[model samples]
Target chain A: MNVRRNLAGVLALCAVAMIFLPLLLTFYLSVFDETLIVFPPHGYTLRWYARIWPEFGAALRTSFFAALAAVAVSLLIGVPAGIGLARYRFRGRDAVATMLLAPLTVPGIAIGLGIFVLAVLIEEHTEWAISGSLALMVAAHVLITTPWVVRLCLASLANHDAAAEEAAASLGARPLAVLWRVTLPAMRSGIVAGGLFAFIVSFENLEMTLFLTAPGMTTLPIAVLQYLQYHIDPLVAAIAVAQVVFVGGALMLLDRHVKLAQVVA
Target chain B: MVEEEHPARLKSVSKRTAATGFLGPATLVVTVMLAAPLLLLLRFSLNRFDIKELMIETVTAENYLRFFTDPFYLGVLRTTVLVAVTSTVLCLLFGLPLAYRLARSQSRWKSLCMLAIVLPLFVGSTVRMVGWMILFAHGGMLDSAVRWVNGVGLEVMYTPFAVVAGIVSINLPYVVLTIQSAIETIDIRIEEAAQSLGAPPGRQFWLVVWPLALPGTAIAGILCFILAMNAYATPYLLGGPRFQMMAPLLYWEFSTNNNWPFASALALILMSTTLVLTACSNLLIPRRYRA
Candidate 1:
C-alpha cells in the first residue's frame, strides 16, 4: 500500500514537473547571453527581452486587436444565445444549441481552410475583397470564440434561480428591463470569463490564422513560427516568456473573480 | 389555474418571441460564417483542381482516390495515426494517476496545482514547441545532461519522438482535468466501503472507481485523440519537414501547392476520421453511463 501510494505521489510530481519544466526552461533560455543556445551559458543578460518589441511588435499588435475584437463580438452575440438556450424551449432549440457549439468539436485547421476557401470564392464572385483582411480573421475568431462564451454563460446560468427574473416580470417590469437588471448581472462572471478565454484563444491561435494571414500581415504566433523557421535565438524565447507571463497573469487574476476551473468543468 | 390561463398563454407567446430574438444574431452569424464556409469547402473538395483557375467546377472523387491510392499519402496517414495514438495512450497513463491524486488530495495548494496544469494550456503550442526545441536540440538541455554523464551528446530534435513528447505535454493537462472532475464525482464512501470489506487498493479501484470513472476516461481519451490527430504546430515544429502529419500536410497542399481540391479533401478525411473514431468509442461505452 505504501509503495503504491509513493508511486502515485512520484508520478503526480513528475506530471507537474513535465508541465512546468518547459515553461521554466523557456524563461531560462531567454536569459542566455549567447546567440546560439548551448548548455550552460557563460553569462546571462536581459538583451532578448529588450529585442522582442522591435522584432515582432506589429504582429503582436495585430493579434491583440484581433483578439479584443473577437471577444467583443463573441460577447455581443453569444450571451443572448446562451440566455435563449437556458431560458426558453423553442422549436429547433437543440439544433440551434448544437450549431452554436459545433465549432468546438470540428478541427480548427479544417475550419481555417474552409473559411479561407470561402473568402476566396467570395472575392472571386464579388467586388468586396474579403481574403486576408483583419475583418475576416476576426470573423473566424468570433466563430470559434462564440461557442466558448455561450458555454460559459450556460454554465453560469445552470444553477441560477429564474425566480428573480420572474419576480421582476411579475412586478410589471418588461422583459428587456428584467434582462438588463437581473439576467445580465447574473451572467456577468460568465461574460468576463468568456471574454478572457476568447482573447486567449484568438491571441494564441495558429492553425486557423495561418491560412487567413496575408504576406505582410500576421499574428504573434505566426510571427514566432516564421521567425523560428529562420532563426534559433534567445529572442524568441524571451517573446515566449512574455506571452506566458501575460496569459498566466490574466488567468490568475480572472480566477479570483470567476472560478475558472468550475467554469471550464 | 383557470384565472392564470390568459396570462400564462401570453407569457408563453412572449417567451417564444424572446427566444427567437435572442438567438437570431448568433444563429445567423454561425450559419453565414461557419456553416456556409464548410459547405463551400465540401463543394470544393468535389471539384477538380486547376492550377490556372484554382478550381474547376466539377463533381469528382479524384482527390479522395489519389489520397487513398498513393502509398506515400497512406504512409503519412499511418504516421499521423501512430503519433496520435501513442500520445493519447501516454496522456491517459500519465493523466489518470495524477488526476486521481489531485481529485483525492486535501492539500491547501490543490487549486494552485490545478492552476499549474491549466496555465500551460493557455500558452500557445508554438511557445511550448519552442521550449521543447531547446530541450531536444543538439547541445541543448537533454543533450548536455546525457553528455555530462556519458560524454556523448544526444540529438532527438526534429524527430517523431520529440513530436510525440511535445504533443503529450500539450494534451496531458486536458486529460488530467477531465478525469479529475470525473473522479471528484465518485463518492469517497464507496472506496471506504470497499476498504472495510478488505479489498486491496488495486481491487478497490478496479471494482469501484474504474467503472464509475470509465465514462470520463473515455471522454478524455476521445478529446486527446482528436486533438492529437488534428495537431499542427507540434508536428510542424518538432516533427520537422521530413515528418508529415495530416493538418500540416493539408496546409502544405493548400498553401504551397495551391491544390485547394486536394487540401479540402484532406481536411474532410481528417475530420471524418476523428468523428468516426469518436463515435466508435462512444458506442463502446455502456449506455447507462453515456449522459
Candidate 2:
C-alpha cells in the first residue's frame, strides 16, 4: 500500500513539474540581466520587461483587439446558436452541432491555409481584399473560438429548468422578457466560461493567425516567433512572462467562479 | 393548463422560424467562411501552379504525384507520424498514472495538480516552445543540471528528441485531464466489490477500472496523436531549420516557395489522414463506449 501510494505521489509530482517547470523557467529567464538567456543570471533586472513595449507594443494591441473582437463576435453568434440547440427541437440539429464542433478536429494550419487561399482568391477575383484585414483575423479566430462558446453554453443549458421560463411566460411575461430575465441568467456561468475559453483560444492561437496576419498588423505570438527567429533575447522572455502573468490572473478568476474539473469534463 | 393557449399563441411555423432566426447567422458564417474555404482548398490542390501568373490555373495531379513519388517527402511524412505516435504513447504512459491518482485521491493536493494541468492550456504554445528552447539549449539549465550530475553537458536543441519532448509537455496535461474525467465516471462501488471478493488492488483496476476507462484512454491517445501530428509552433521553434514536420513543410510551400497547389495538396493529405484515422478509431470503438 505504501509503495503504491509513493508511486502515485511521484507520478503526480512529475505531471505538475511537466506543466509548470517551463513557465517558471520562462519567468526566471525574463529577469536575467544578461541579454542572452543563460542559467544562473549574474543579476536580476526589469529592463527586458520595460523594453517590451517598444519591441512588441503594436503587435500586443493587435492581438488584444483581435481576441476581444473574436470573443464578442463569437458570443453574438454562438449564444443564440447555443440557445437554439439547447432549447429548440429543430430538424438537422445534430448536423448543426457537428458543424459547430467540426473546426475542433481540423488542423489549425489547414484552416489557416484554407482561409488564406480563399482570401487570396477573393483578391484575385474581386476588389474586396481581406488578406491583412483585422476583420479577417477576427473571423478566423471566430472559427476557432465559437465552438467552445457553443459547447460550453450547450453544456450549461443541458440541465437548465425550462419550467421556470414557461412559468414566467404563462404569467404574461413576453418571450424576450423571459429570455432577458430568466434564461440568460441561468446560462450566465456557461456564457462566462465560453467567453473565457474563446478569449484564450483566440489570443494564444498561432497557426491560423500566421496566415492571416499582414506585415504591419502582426499579433504578439507572431511577433514573438519573428523575434525568436532573429534573436534569442530576454525581451522575448519578458513578453512570455507577461502573458503567463495575465493568464494566471484570469485562471484565478476562473477558479473562483467555476470548478476546473467540471469545466474540463 | 396554460399549455393549450401557449401552443395557440406560439404556432409551430413561428417556432421553426424563431429557431432559424437564432441559428441562421452561425450556420451562414460557418458555411461561407469555414466550409467554403475548405472546398476551395480542394479545388486549389487539383490545379497546377503557374509561376509567372503566381496562382494555380490548370488542373493537374502533379503536386500530389510529386508528394507521393518523392522519397524526401515520404521521409518527412514518416518522421511526422513517428514523432506523433511516439509522443502520444509517451503521454499515455505518463498521464495515466497521474490521472488515476487524481481520480482516486481526495487530497487537497489533487486540486492543485488538476489546476497545474489546465493552466498550461491558457499559455501560448509559442511561449512554451521558447521555454523548451532555453532549457534544452547548449549551456542551458538542463545542460547545467546534467553536467552537475554526470560531469558532462548535453546539447539537445534542434534534435528530434527536443521536438518530441516539447510535444509531450504540450500534450500531457490534456491527456491526463481527459483520462481523469473518464475515470471519474466509473463507480467506486465496483472497486469496493472487487476488493471485498479478495482481489488485489492492481487486479481490481485491471479487471474493473481499466475496461471502463479504456475507451476514454483511447480517445485521449487519438487526441494527443492528432495534436502532436498537427503541431506547428513547437516543431517550428524547437525543431529548428534542420528538422521538417508536415505542418512546417506545408507552411514553407505556401509562404516561402509560393507554391499554392503543392501546399494545398499537402494540407489535403495531412487533413485527410487525420480525419480518416479518427474515423477508423471511432469505428473501432463500440458506439456505447465511444465519446
Candidate 3:
C-alpha cells in the first residue's frame, strides 16, 4: 500500500511539473537579454515587456474589444437559454440543447471556414461589406462562447431547487418579478463564470479568427503567429507570459466564487 | 373547478411562451451564424472552382473526388489520423495514473492539484506551443543539455515528435479531468473488496478498477482524439510548414491557395471523420459499460 501511494505521488508530481515547466520556461525566456534565443543567457532584461505594446497594440485592442463584445452578447442570449433548458423541459428540449452545443463538437477550423465563406457570399450578394469586419468575428466568437455560458448556467441551476421561485410565484409575485428577484440572482456565479470563460475563449481563439481578420485587423494570437514566422524573439514570449498571468489569475480568483472545477467536471 | 382548470391551462400556455421567449435569441444566433453558414459551405464545396471566377455555381463532386483520389491529400489525412491517435494514446497512458491518484487522494491539496491541471488549459494552445518552441529549438534547453552531456546538439524542433509532444501537453489535462470524474463514480469499496480477497495491487487495478473505468477512459480518449485531430496552432507552430495535418492543410487551401471549394470539402471531410469515429466508438463499447 505504501509503495503504491509513493508511486502515485511521484506520477502526480511529474504530471504537475510537465504541465507547469513550459509556462515557467516561457517566463524565463521572456526576460532573456539576447535577441536570438539561446540556452543559457549571459544576462536578463525587461525590454521585451516594454516592446509588446508598440508591436502588438492594435491587435491586442481588437482582441480585447472583440472578447468583451462576445461576452456581453453570449450572456444576453445564453443565460435565458440555460434557464429555459434547466428550469423547464418542453418538447425538443434535447434538440435545442444539442444545437446550442453543436459548435463545440465541430472542428473550429471548419466553422471558421464556413463563416468566412458565408461572409464572402453575403458580400457578393449584397453591398454590406461584411467580410473581415470585427462584427463578423464577434458573431463567430458568440457562437462559440454562448455554449459555455449555457452549460455553466445549467450547471449552476442543477443543485438549487426551484422552490424559492415557486414560492415567490405562489405569493402573487409576477413571473418577471420572481425571475428578477430570485432566479437571476441564483445564476449569478454561473453567469460570471460563463463570461470569464467566454472572454478567454474569444481572446485566445486563432483557427476561426484566422480566416476572418483583414490585413490591418488581427487578434493577438495572429499577431504572435505573424511575428514568429519572421522572428523568434523574446517579445512573443513576454506577450505569452502576460496572457498566462492575466488569465490564470482571473481563473483562480473566479474559482473561489464559482467552483469552476465543478462546472467543467 | 372551472377556475382551477383555466389557470392550469393558462400556466401551460405561459410555460411554452416563456421557453420560446428564452430560447429564441440563442436559437436564432446559432442558426444564422453556424448552421446556415455550414449549409452554404456544403453548397460551395459542390460548386466548381475557377481561378478567375473563384467559384462557378455548378453542382459537381470534383472537389471531393480530388481529395479522395489525390495521393498528397490522402497522405495528409493519414498523417493527421496517425498524429491524433498517437497523441490520444499517449495522453491516456500519462493521464490515467495521475487521474486515478487525484480521484482517490484524501489529501487537502487535491483541489489545488486539480487547479494546477486546469490552469494550463485556460492559457490556450498558442502560448503553450511557444513554451515548447523554446524547449525544442536548436540552441534551446534540450539541445544545450545534450551538447553538455554528449558534445552534440539535439535537433527536435519542427519534427513530428515535437508536434506530438506539444499536443500531448495540451491534451493531458483534459484527459485527466474526464477520467478523474469517471473514476470518482466508481466506489472505492470495490477495490478494497478485491484487495481483502488477496488480490495484488496490479490485480486489483486490472480486475476491479479497469472494467468500471472503461467508459470514462473511452470518453477521455475520444475527446482527446477529436481535439488533436482538429488541432491548428500546435501543428502550425511545432510541426512547421513541412508538416501536413488536415486542419493546417485546410487552412492553407483556403487562405494561401484560395481554393475555397477544396477547403470546404476538406472541412466537411474532417468534421465527418471525427463525428463518425466518435459515433463508431460509442457503438463499439459494450452495452454494460456504456452510460
For each candidate, report what fraction of the true interface contacts it reproduces. 0.60, 0.51, 0.55
Runs of candidate 1 with Cα error greater than 4 angstroms are A163-174, A259-265, B1-5, B103-106, B181-216
Please tell me which model should have the higher DockQ, number 1 or number 3.
1
Model 1 per-residue lDDT at B74 = 91
Model 1, residue B203: displacement in angstroms? Answer: 5.7
Ten-residue region with minimum lDDT total, candidate 2 chain A = A256-265
Q: Every model's DockQ, to 2 decimals? A: 0.57, 0.53, 0.53
Please list the Cα RMSD from the true structure of every candidate, rounded to 1 decimal place. 2.7, 3.2, 2.9
What is the TM-score (0 to 1) of candidate 1? Answer: 0.92
lDDT tens digits, residues B25-61, model 3?
9988987888887898899899888999887888999
Give the candidate order by descending TM-score: 1, 3, 2
- Residue pairs in steric clash, candidate 3? none
lDDT of 1 at B51: 82
What fraction of native interface contacts does model 1 preserve?
Answer: 0.60
Q: What digit string (tens of lDDT, one per residue) describes model 2 on residues A87-128? A: 899779999888988887888889899998888878989999
The Cα local distance difference test for each model comes to 0.86, 0.84, 0.86
User: Residue B32: error of model 1 in Å?
Assistant: 2.5
Alpha-carbon DockQ of candidate 1: 0.57
Weakest lDDT window of 10 consecutive positions for candidate 3 chain A: A256-265
Residue A265 displacement (Å), model 3: 4.7
Model 3 regions more than 4 Å off = A1-11, A252-265, B100-115, B177-220
